[model samples]
Target: MTDSPEFKDEESIRRGQEFINEVYRKMSRIAEEFAAGEINRAQFHRLYNRYQRQIMTVSQMIAESDPSGWETAVKSDESTLHIRRQFEAKAIGLSIYDNRTGMPIETIGDFSLDAELIVPMLSSYRQATAEIFQAGVRSTEMENGQWLCFMSGAYTTLIVLFSVEPSSNRIMLLDRMHRDFEIANAEFLEHGYTSADQLAYPFYSFIKRSPLDTQDLETELDE
Candidate 1:
């Protein structure tokens, strides 16, 4: 078996300790995700164990370097734990679908999915939602880690494709945007929304809003 890494200098020890602390921070986030129901128990268990093992391996490396390395890390533990971790999910695409016809009213942004493929999936989702507990929002992560945010309104459904799992704040903004869309186009939607231009596309501006801002839709920047 190979021996653990040894660092003779303070800078190397500091960098190694930083890595260990970074792993700790990741473990902390995983725990938070489990608590917030963002991750299931199994996922949390796997991620937690992986991070834990990584920390162990790295800690051994650093310990074999400077016996005081752990002591140095301990001094800043509280401050490191208190660091706020911000999550940003990139907006990949946005689509508005007519609930009655399962037809897409508008689709824009950088998504690669054809409307043909999405319609059947939306149908299945709607059927399942009708049969099961239908919530205000449905966030799904694909096998490859792409995130889909589905927000339904009275007249239409909003489908947002995201680069990664969005935060609760971003999801809330989407929910608000869907609600606003219904209200903004209430007249046209209630009567008959013949064309995408007939309704005001509130989400049009949101397409440009990437890496999601901390501000909400109501406080959205005017462009």
Candidate 2:
């Protein structure tokens, strides 16, 4: 893949961070307006979500430019550090859907973030937003302390449900996963393949290996 021109050097990274901070400033302003009852909840929610997507996209762009730099920057920033803990995933999977038909065509997960949650998340998005087609992230509070984080791309979506244990750093992770999905399934996604059996066969094993299971195995080994 060709390198992105936007994030090529230290200067570019600095500019990206500035843009991200500006986006956060807007988010903070929106939050204050919501709290003051100047803007209703719907407007606040929509604008807040848009700003979030902007931050996530910009961070991903920077990370793609300099992964190590992005890591250091995230660690230095307290708010980003906090966010890093909030979006930690227990399991992650890539799923494809047909935007034209509004049907989920394929799912390849065997973890807690099941196929069942997709439609509901999409339904909630439709109910909550004016734009049904915009690709973005959504989170659903599951029973107990788990949260299902959904990040959508062109006609595909990535589902990552976080563990009940406290964790952080989801937005960038979701973006990376979405990018990987694009790279891994470029042909099928481009051609509009709708068969689950055909498209999911290769990734089935990946989705079945939950990150939580790896943690459990590590704990057992330590014990």
Candidate 3:
């Protein structure tokens, strides 16, 4: 007898839904356990915070219309961290960084920040945004049958690694993901932090496209 494909199209959709449902169930269980005094308040807070962050991250991925799939990690400063929710058999890891200092507070595992990886990832994000605005096409490449990536925005990028099957629909996925990313980006901008310079590199210098004007925030507040 021949073995079945790792995922049929219908099965893929079903599994995607199942993964999301499982994540929800896990988060709910954590919340219930915390409420029942099985976990301490601090533990509950950490779990809840992680859940919130994961939801935001996952929402971006979903909005970007990713097909290879995505997962999130939420780590804390302490050593007793645990994965409160996992959607797939694939690994999910998190590294918490001090927003003020750009220093890592804690990393769940070996989540190294690679500039070579990040540069292309950021480029993909820019292309995604441009495609959405112009209704153009997008594509992605799989390296050594292992990694797949689709960019959602400047700060958020989705990376999926193949454990079972290699990504074959990367181009189609990238195009569709870009559409979803556009909608998510619009919503993200409405919540503030739209400029890349503002959120990612507040200290970097750039040649302005036009003359810089002093915003109300730039004006000094009267004591």
Candidate 4:
């Protein structure tokens, strides 16, 4: 069998590793504070959600070696609304929708799709879905400098579109998307959720229950 593609040179890999470690350290500190009750549940949830997003972003950066990666990142701001109750102090806008039914749960911002955008997205989804059906490997596509679509299985697909150019590495983008599907699928299989609504329930519950208390927050000290 052919060997896997070698990553960048040792120095680059080391730098990437250092950056990832720093992020992980920060996440770990937040997680520890959360576990210790130094930070309330809402604060912890917000930090965790942000941390997860950062992990995905970092993974994409490592995979693509691109500095301007956030442009292509899936707009999780739309997902944050569901968890607003958990940390009301933070400004988060994330809306979750049923991939099949097109129904939205938490409407934080408009992730609207026009005909021009939807047509190509659906087409790419279809092609990727067909290929996955035949081959076990997933497929993704980037087109028109604005959209990135991934299809892994009959029931699993992710679409990220941007209003501007994406500075993300293609391979890393697919890797993170694949990881998300794996987690979501595992949860669905364990719970027997037929819709994305069910899959998003835990997050929604967290947000609704965890609204942040700004009164408890201390003002930042001047540097």
Per-prediction TM-score to the true structure, in the order listed: 0.60, 0.41, 0.27, 0.31
TM-score head-to-head 1 vs 4, winner: 1
Better of 3 and 4 by lDDT: 4
Model 3 agreement with the true structure over 108-203: per-residue lDDT tens digits = 322344747645654665566666774333224445433333334332333333222222233344435434544555454445444443332211
In candidate 3, list every pair of residues with a backbone clash.
64-177
lDDT top scorer? 1
lDDT of each: 0.70, 0.58, 0.42, 0.46
Candidate 3: residue 91 lDDT (0-100)? 20
Q: Number of backbone collisions per candidate, in order?
A: 0, 6, 1, 18
Model 2 clash pairs are: 84-168, 84-169, 85-167, 85-168, 85-169, 86-168
Candidate 4, superposed: residue stretches over 4 Å from native: 1-109, 115-120, 132-145, 151-154, 170-174, 189-192, 195-197, 200-223
| Candidate 1, residue 90: lDDT | 64
User: For model 4, what is the error of residue 115's alpha carbon versus the real structure, in angstroms, after optimal superposition?
Assistant: 5.7
Evaluated against the true structure, the overall lDDT of model 1 is: 0.70
lDDT of 2 at 30: 68
Tens-digit lDDT string for candidate 4 (1-223): 7543454344445665676677688778877765554554555667677767766776676677764344345344444445433443321222333345444323322345554755565556566556565433332333542333333433443344332222223324444544565476666634446554344322222222333343433342322
Give the least accurate 10-residue stretch of model 2, judged by summed lDDT: 161-170
Kindly list the per-residue Cα lDDT of model 2 for residues 126-223, writing each as its tens digit.
45543665545676667776666666666565555545321223355556666676677678777877566455233433454533456665798999
- Residue 1 C-alpha lDDT in model 3: 68
